[model samples]
Target: MTPGLPMPVPAPGLPARVRIHEVGARDGLQNEQTVIPTEIKAEFVRRLAAAGLDTVEATSFVHPKWVPQLADAERLFPAVRDLAPEVRLPVLVPNERGLDRALTLGADRIAVFGSATESFAKANLNRTVDEALATFAPVVARAKEAGAHVRGYLSMCFGDPWEGPVPVPQVVRVCRALLDQGCDELSLGDTIGVATPGHVTALLTALNEAGVPTDVLGVHFHDTYGQALANTLAALQHGVTTVDASTGGLGGCPYAKSATGNLATEDLVWMLRGLGIETGVDLERLTATSVWMAERLGRPSPSRTVRALSASLGSPDSLDSHKE
Candidate 1:
């Protein structure tokens, strides 16, 4: 215990609790060329829950024309409704229509996405940033009435594809607006993976100045330039807790050209454990599951740690690079 501070009461073995909202079933599977069957989606959710992820973004309740893959979200939601009672399965609602669908499916938690860049907003949401927020107001109000938890996503918080560097002021404005309107938590997304540790601190600092509580903020970063984990650590130091990570580094924003996969769960777990942060994740199990997922996707695993560990499994020398 630190000097002058009471020691924390120790239990037999208290698990370190960290909130990981898995987006693999929705964010990961959405962009694939092949339409993953609904059964597969449910099984994927079950597996993720079994792996000890307490929160999972199960699917997006959007129009079939917009995201044909998740069109059967209603069916998928019910299939996995029997998940361990402790796990939360939040779905994404793009608008009032989607929110209604989520409500119909008995969704108790939902997430909404807003953009920080006008150009990216125009391209993806077909509206200005303000317009997109306005479009979600009714959805937010309805969600609150239904007693559901709402997580807001602010995309392109660090950089924009068309506009390049996004002003910190702009990010703060959007984040404040989302909280003011009503969102339990706001996840600031480095949609393009261009954020540095400095940028992360600056943005969070600005948000703090704007009266948004740090605990209500979460970090969602991509590893396109190998900075996602770095940025995540910076955010943690900045007093921001709760992070968004995909299992096995499963997905990236398809609309953001330079964007790559999310910070690998295994990689994030490794860092958190090193810091003694207690993410409550089973690293060995998570890594093995990631390997199984990589095989299913038929692609090279995006996680460096996963690759190194896989090679280590084949030969002891392969583990040298990861040794402390």
Candidate 2:
């Protein structure tokens, strides 16, 4: 720690207020091979809401054939619908079919994903990038008519598994399209977790120059390469305030081979606190919850900071023993 340097300085140009949309219940559990009981999912949603997360992605309305893990989204939604009326329970809607399912379940906030990489788009959605975006127009319009807020996700913005380096123009074009399609906000996903700080700067700069306003952009990063926090700092410097992270670093891309985990929520909160940003997340509570989840899964946490902090918390006290 630097002398006289107060921890948690707010990033420049970032709004004094920032929103963190918790994805642990949905994105976090979607990748788990074990079928989390619907009750467990509901309980997790309750805990997350109680932990001061105003936005929690409760579940995805995708078909079981495509994502069997979230097959119980319909069962999960109504169970936790009234957890906190102020807390937004956004659900992922893949296409018109998924949209219909969400609407049937009375979804209020919806998210749709598109890919900046052509190869990832075909592999993940079985369509070209443009074709995938085209499918969302009707879905977005319908959701809007039904008084739902729409959020757009642009995946593989940093690099692609099959295509390698994704061009800046490609990312900007996808972002613009999503914004133009009536999405209230757009999230740029580093799906492969291959983004460096320089890559983050260049991408956000290009997107801004292309007229994608900073207020409407969010950053979703994976910690596969352990660079998520750093990349997030770059995004914050670029004036992006909203970020997506999993509770225990629990999610990964199914179509992205060899990818690891989503950025840990505990680590993001820790970094934000250290930088003087107010995430309004209870770090102690989040850290304990993360430790509990990691134990439940029988896997070590993917967050280096969380692991270190947990180790220290469990260590013997040095209060009276420090004299030696």
Candidate 3:
């Protein structure tokens, strides 16, 4: 057994493997007020891929006016795209124009962000819920026609700041619409991080009962209330195989004021490794990657696993050269 890794406990009823959909590059950096250089962002994607995170969200094609941080999507995409086929580098496409931009850049995995409530729709996309769905419809269709894997992200699945706890049925409706619109899978977002274990299970049950298959669902939890891992355990219990995480808990909802950092990838890997679930992630290397990133951002990593491992390893002297 590795020094920092856990003993293999092999939890029963959990899947033998879970795919960690890494979002540290795009979703992680999108909300940054300080614009990181395009090369640095590209290098971040490369380092993440080198750390054994096979599915990394590279960047978004959302207009620069909306998200200045990701305005370099075109340059960043090409820089890390060669890692694709081996690594699934998914990009966020905001609308048809965004889709066109991504398609031209050879982005084979594309994601569309949607809101489960009206207020967020207005705030984020400047449209109503249905209007946002309608906009995504053509993008999904075109992506499918282009032989791309489409992931639909439904935000505010648990609770909304302006509208309190959201109904499961409302989320299910939007999820069904996205799937119907040709999304290969759906990622349910706990945007406000207000979900408990019971709420997590209940919503998964509701979506399943509404004819959504478990195999095609993913969970994206925020750690605002420190319930992310607990909520993730609930998700895993429900047979969810796809988990979205940001390295070092690097992101938040820029549009949603009350939202916080995403569930940290290093933390998730530690917990999953303890359970003996195969994620094909190297905890040591991933921790180093996080530490390097933390230094680049001039702060300590928020991920407990990263902090613990860094301390145990006596501060990774270098993250400058990530092994290929």
Candidate 4:
């Protein structure tokens, strides 16, 4: 038995398929009050992979002091590191030491987090925007040297709480700097969840004008103002194929209290399926994973799709086949 799917209606000017960059394990759970067990995190990764997420960002290699929730990065990566070769399990690395730890664990898919604005850079990394980029330079270099694919994450690209509306040129400059530093691709983060469709298009246009091809760009939006999916569609219209999301709508930035959860993977899948934009995700299987995770987290999932399916299907037993 499967959950209901939207009627497929092909959209013009969109990619035939999009690579959903699942960030639930790292970005989703980082702000939780309680720490999720290592085994549970591993199981989540397994379930997501089984549900057909090609790239599941596994965990972060930052100091435990900064994010105690994912302190088990050392333990968690190994547990899920042996997933199918086609499945890409990327991990976030904060600096050279973090990169060292990830490389030691055979994590070839690495992402370095940065900020497009000075305020967020200071608040999140305690460095200016330039300082943060400078810090990431060596990490990106070493990872690339080791034949690892590097993704650069620039947060607060659309808007910043302290700085207000971020200029398009400012974001374009930082994006170029990251690519120039040898990043394989870039994910523009609407960290505070304030971006609208116009702002999203503007950034993509500016980046393209700056020579950052749409193919090397990914969009990471939050649903704070109910604009994540809209912003995603704008990026899609611009020819971006990599979209970042968390399962079950499970996370928010610990630094930006106003920031809500990452774009829910289940929600993204539903829209993609409806638009006839393939994402290779099994919505029922993905929803089951969310249900299972919700039970573990002791809270109901915030994803509209997950909630609806779980309510209509009304049986956890039915979702078991998809669970890992």
TM-score against native, each model? 0.88, 0.90, 0.94, 0.94
> What residue pairs clash in candidate 4, if any at all?
none
Better of 1 and 3 by TM-score: 3
Q: How big is the positional error of residue 270 in model 2, measured in Å on the Cα after superposition?
A: 0.5
Question: What is the lDDT for 203 in model 3?
Answer: 91
lDDT by residue (142-254, candidate 3, tens digit) is 99999999999999999998999999899999999999999999999999889999999999999889999999999999998889999999999999999999988888544
Candidate 1 structure quality by residue, lDDT tens digits, 1-324: 112212334333223445776777888778766677898778788878887778888999988898888988989999987687888999999999899989988899999999998998999999999999999888888899999999999899999989999999999988888887789999999888999999999998888888887888888998888899989878877766588888777784455432356877777777766665666666666666766666666664667767666665542222444444
Write down the RMSD of candidate 1 (Cα, Å). 6.1
The list of candidate 2 runs beyond 4 A from truth reads 1-6, 9-15, 253-260, 312-324
Q: Which stretch of 10 consecutive residues in model 4 shows the poorest summed lDDT? A: 315-324
Q: What is the C-alpha lDDT of each candidate?
A: 0.80, 0.82, 0.89, 0.90
**RMSD per prediction, one decimal?**
6.1, 4.2, 4.4, 4.1
Report lDDT (Cα) of residue 254, candidate 3: 49
lDDT of 4 by residue, 228-299 (tens): 998898889889999999998889645444344689899899999999998889999999999999889877
How many clashes in candidate 2? 5
* Model 2: per-residue Cα lDDT over 1-324, one tens digit each: 113213766656755656898888888888888887898789888877777788999999988988899999879999998787789999999999999999888889999989998899899899999899999999999999999999998999989988888888989988888889999998889888889989988988888898877888899998877799999988888878899988867786454432457888887887787777877777666666667666666665666555656664562211122222
Better of 1 and 2 by lDDT: 2
Position 266, candidate 4: lDDT: 90
Off by over 4 Å in 3: 1-3, 253-260, 316-324
